[model samples]
Target: MSMGTQGAGAGLTRPAPATRAALLVLLVGAACLLLGPRLPWLVEWPAGWTVPATDWVGAALEWLLGGIKPVARGFSEMLRYPMDWADAALAVTPWPLVIGLVTALGWAIGGAPMAALGAVGLGFVLASGYWVQSMNTLALVAVSVPLALVLGMGIGILANEVPRLRGPVQVLLDVMQTVPTFAYLTPLLLLFGFGPVVGLIASAIYAAPPMARNVLLGLERVDSQIKEAAIMSGGSRLQQLFQVEIPSAGTQIMVGVNQCLMAALSMVIIAAVIGGFDDIGWEVLLTMRKAQFGQSLLAGLVIVAFAVIIDRMSAALASERNRQDQRVTAGLVLLAVAVTALFWRSLPDPAGFTLLAPVAEAVDRGLGAFTAANGATLDAIKNGAMFYGLLPLRIGLDDAVLEFTWGFQWTPAMSLALYALAAAGGLVLAFAGRATAGALLVIAVGILETGVANLAWPFVLTGAAALAWLAQGRKLALIVTLLLLTILLSGLFPRALLSLYLSGAAVFACALFGGAIGLVCAVSPLAWRMMRPICDMLQTIPLFVFLIPVLMFFQIGEFSAFLAICAYAIVPMIRYTRHGLVSTPTEMLEAATASGATAWQTMRDVRAPYAAPTILLGLNQTILYAFAMLVIAALIGTTGLGQSIYLALGQADVGLGISAGAAMAILALIADRLVQGFAEERRRALGL
Candidate 1:
């Protein structure tokens, strides 16, 4: 009579009482999903309700504040006096003074270019009429980033040291990373009363996960042999950590710092919504809300400039540290002092200037002009394109996809068929091995349960394209196929599939383009010299900031989003491809040359194939970068799983958001497994 008995009667025996309890839990969850939303009591709040304890606390705080009112007011006034002086000093400072300071600091740390870049970026922000707001933004970042870094490093170190805690910490970090930023606002608002402090706290929490994960990665990667050697030398724990682990892991930790800074920057705009002080985030948010496109765009640009300059400077410093360049160290110190002086001298007096008013006016005019000139055009284009172009194509493609899925008997039942085939194929390919049967089976059943069999054709086509490109070395065919599939998938399911395709296409295109560019740069000494700074900038620059200028030029759409994706995705491809080409065993290259092979022949037969697996791994990373960009792309009007996830955040639809996020994870997992499998096979073939 029980649920377990009913389940058993249906030939699916519940495992045990504990299992039955879990099943009951699942049933209750389902019931909640079905009924909770429509329940009146769930939606409504009791009227005129006040908690006595909360009132008592408020009264107590008020009474305490009243008693210390004079002291509190005096303290606030005292703080303001110095702030006033600093502001006055900053506002009257000559531009050259600031620039010189920045240049000097840069020269002391890493040298000329980095110092110059920092000075120039900061100057631009100030000159472009954002000095005060910029300072405010900088203040928040200065506070939050360090906190995030310390916490992340501490947690990471703890997790790494204790093996048992690693799994749970990782899981928590994963959930935190995937959870929408908006959800934190509600709880934070309740606790911190919607101020810059709350915003900083939220930003720190959001950013810390990546830093922690990266720290753990770096620590774990430290050579065990080196640690043992340190131990043998009678090194204390602190000594070992500082000398052995920390130094070795410095590069990754710096990378984590880069990630943390970028994440903090992302919160700037959002923080405005929750009473962020200093008007930088506020300006962007207000401009956007007020339809001040140009102003909003400009504010976003300022943020990007800051991000880029800091990125370049930090990267140079980190790299220079690795090389142990005293020049870099001295340059950084000088640069820092210069920056400090500039900031100190250029700080604005809050009392004298009406900063926000000018900003608001400029933004209003810009928005008005933009609306007058391009608003109608954009609307018309969007409407016509949606109706005449996108809608029709989407409809036809959707129909075709549906037909393909339903028409072939093998397709609707493809999950089962694929599993059976993969299992059989694995057995045959491995000489009757079943090493991965369980995994394959679980994947297949999961796909079936999720109803993704409806997308079988495109999936298979993509797989085929990957295989063909890998096996036959048909570059043009591969490119064409990839683009075609991307377009088709984009049309068929624009909401979910388009973003995926765009990401893939962007990665592929950027890889190809970057590879060519890298080769050209590498071939010419002068060009290589010219490109070194650029590459450094690219590596150090935050990925999120890449979206800002892109949005400026292209506006919100697929193009801007794709451009952002390409900018971030191309870096690894360029680096790896160049490394692979340069590192292709010297003996092999010599033998090929000795055998009278042409340069082209040597490259095609020797270098290309030799670098295939490494290049594939780069491609894998590019795909991941692309996928990661999807959520960011939503700011530019992408409607897909990304949009779904975004909406879920806005509405507090955790279940819906998580489910959609799962779909993305599944997509990543499938691509990862397939490419990795192919890579492994190729590596084995090459005896690598």
Candidate 2:
């Protein structure tokens, strides 16, 4: 019995598999660092070693596209008819009638609030002097949304009906969601040869996944008893699906509709980059390029107005509340008709209405004045962040710590001192039984000293594998290793690193600030009240519009892009963090109180641990958001795979665009998997 007890104790004292992996990773990193100076290949990938994967991808796609170009063009031509009809219908419709129709529809879908939203939102659009441009955009959305709905619904139904297809369908959707918006434009541009057709198709493709996902969710959530009842009622599978299951899932399907509308609208605007349509998005782009900041803001607002109206109206459909009276809707429509008919001859063209144009001009002048006045201050902030923060992360201390920038040149001796300090701290942590954290601290210091872009390939792989292994098990670690290896072989590894660096920097900034704000919001209801609307507005606005405000203050640069990414990505962090913290169970709080815990102590010891998985998921979302915005930021001024994708879009290089997109997607997938793994582990530990 004594010998058995000793064996059990010894077994319990052994380090976990994760700890062992971390130690192995640390050893690999240390070896790489020590030998790196003598081995150039350790610091950078050798050119001779990279496969010409991009060229091969290009060749394969060119051949494939050559075979399918005729069919694709035929389909494009087929799609053109509805797009043209929709465009002409909206174009010819009188502005008043259109506004009235939207208001009435809003009433039918929601109530007075939605009706008012429709009226005021459309009123702003009409007043912005971009009414004609807005019409062009609306027409594109009008046609593309239905196409997306049908395609997405069909996919969802098929996936639900066929179990084997579900996994593949889901995987495809994940890829679609992670791939940057601009990446879709390249191959489509090649297929369609530069037209609104490309935007139409791209918007449809981009917008479909949300609907498909929601449809699948809705169908799956239908009560099993309901399914049995339908079967007992002698309903055919088709009848059950279409008449019973679908109607039963109306709320979720409506939610899908809302997402589909928002996505289509956002994509249509982004597709303006292709420049075949005279939509509001194109107007914003045109004015922005001309340095007409005021006009750009106005056009962007028009897009925003449209987004809000569409979002609110569709969202209301998912609500259980009864819609407003039909008589009110009819009265509004009649009023619009009467007004249009009575003033038909004297009515001003909507395009000629420049009520907001003066405001726009003033805004432009004000922005100019503000920038001019604060030019020195802005420059200082920008330079300070770049020199102290982003530059170091990108290029490392050895390169970035220059006499002019950091006021001291980094020497080899300083590097040794940094490593020594890290080692000491790591040892202390290890002694405290936090071996993994200690090892991670040393690895982080090494990364900071070497810089992300200059990281040795083997070190990066080992670190990633360690994280994955700790997060889940061997399978995830191996998967991450293989995926990263593909990027390494693609010749796009350097650009991938740059992309990783920028997105990582933005995510770090977001997590730090966003977590603090969320904590404060959790502690104070008034703070949450103030923040809630701001979060809602930020989320409501499309990703493209985010660039405008950042660009207005900072102009075009990496700093501007970073700020844009943070602004867009920070919402989820704030929301999820607050939610996780505030959602601590009442019993747990009571238990802490009974144990004589103070409010702060309860929060620190009880709330935070329970919220760990939730917070990690929030961080996961922030990471993805950062990557999505990273590509859009490329339009202003950014380097990395985003730039490659954007350049490929312009050049119509299908190979480079797809390959770079895949690399970006791979990076995002890796981050997503690792975070999710950790969150899953936490959940399992809590038996949740």
Candidate 3:
């Protein structure tokens, strides 16, 4: 062929943009690894170039908060009345009456099953002998939830009413979502001093975003025809909004309420770390510190009970199903009153109840015996996971591979061979028409060898740009690069990498394990039936409660933290995976069957690709959940940004707290955008 013909042929064979981006990322990573030893700067940022962003942030916030101290103190005082009222009322209420009231409310909303759940759940809480402590926690929730609801509703309505504010409001909500719950306590801690009011205000602030977001969503989704009808009926703007739009958006608002309740409860428990409350959260912390595992477990269970009851009851409000007879509710309430009157003098203090003490003791004894017998096995499991998985991922194989841990030292020659094999595999894959996959494989190999925390700044930035470009476009790529560069310059990049490593590890495990469980559940109704309630329970339980079981079995370490994160984060993966797989259109299955595809073949070729976007969404949720749990997991022994945030709380260093939180939020926000972009791309590709 002539020279012109050959050039045209080469042009036709050039890779697509995504493929080129992937290859660029791979090359940059490999070059960083090859040059890192000779150019030490490639592997680590210089201290001389670092900005004291933490100190600066602290100084600015201190100035701002100091200015508002008087107003905040007055506000705090005003808020205390409701808090105190709630506490006193709950503290003085008879335990039986509380249970009956909850059961009656449950019956009114959801009928027999909900009523039974409420009764049984409260019964368990009452029997656990933490009634007073539980009530204290509930009081905090009671006061904070109302505050959160009102604040969230106002924000949501304001955003909805003004078109100009919607974007900013959404951005605020998104940022708030990534900020860890504990991070909210630090500045509030300074403002409120050491008291339960800090927890109340912290929780109120932490829980408000969900409500605002949901309310805005609900309002936005209201049928336009309804608004038109209201207008045509000569209703004023406020009348239309209150009487029509808001009422029409009730379901979504109720969803917000449910989420608000959960957030308040979760934050309330976490806020006990500040040592100003005698709530059940405090009880759990106190017992855990004393090594009283049985009592801690009981307290944790009590929290779970409250969570389930609150979650279920609030959730019922959102459903369109017919409610149970109101007379039954009235009867139950009357019965409670009658019983209280009859037994007023003889009733024992709810605090003295210990009906479940023996049960807790048995659990403790059984746990002890099992651990004693399986101590070696448990140690082996933990050691194996650390040596083979986490350690290599943390500090890289070159450093982590040692005679004491991996049984053999990794040598330079072995590294050469590993690179050689990886290059060979990549070449083969490229030749097989999978250039993008091949490039990603090479990049993964480089990361595994170099470790996340040690990655060169240029390489990390390039990789993020490439991924963002592929996921969305130049705009997102620019945004991600800038945000990451800020973290890098701020000197928090190392800790951010550590956070990335742990959350990334947990997400990978969840994607694997939860995906498998989801697949199984998709294939079997019975499996889903069995797993559904467990998933619900896991989701309902507060993030703090997850530490109890893992701490019992594994003790306080990275492993315990890892397990807790996985347990909490895995639910979404499972739920989304099952829903995506099961919700595949019947027509697609029929077509596959007509084409003589086997069940496994249809699943792989038809179902898997169709479910990719949904599965990606699940992965996104899993990532966010893992990051959220990562902060709480710091209480045990996990390191990284989580530890920084927790430490900042202890020292009351608002600067470090806010800066570390911003860094963590940066990572989460980037991950969220990247995953969502990928999911959107998949949806467009599938024409969904």
Q: In candidate 1, what are the lDDT values of residues 127-200, reduced to their tens digit? A: 55666677666666766787789989988998988999999998678657644455444344444444566667
lDDT of 3 at 466: 90
Give the total clashing residue pairs for model 1. 18
Question: lDDT for every model?
Answer: 0.60, 0.91, 0.91
* Residue-by-residue lDDT tens digits, candidate 3, 1-688: 1111123363556576777888888878777777888987777888888899999999999999999999999999998899899999998888778989998998998999999999999899888999888888888999999999999999999999999999999999999989987788899988878889999999999999999999999999999999999999999999999999999999999999999999999999999999557799999989887777888999999999899889988998987868578999999999998998899889899888989999889988998999999999999999899899998898888888999887899998887887788888988888787777777777887788778877888898998999899899999999999999889888999999999999999999999999999999999999999999999999999999899988888899998899999999999999999999998999999999999999999999999999999999999999999999999999999999999999999999999999999999999999999999999999999999
Residue 604, model 3: lDDT of 97
Show the lowest summed lDDT stretch of 10 residues, model 2. 1-10
Those runs of model 2 whose alpha carbons end farther than 4 Å from true positions after fitting are 1-12
Candidates by lDDT, descending order: 3, 2, 1
Residue-level lDDT tens digits of model 2 in 460-516: 898899889888888998999999999998888899999999999999999999999
RMSD of 1: 13.7
TM-score of every candidate? 0.61, 0.97, 0.98
Clash count of each predicted structure: 18, 0, 0
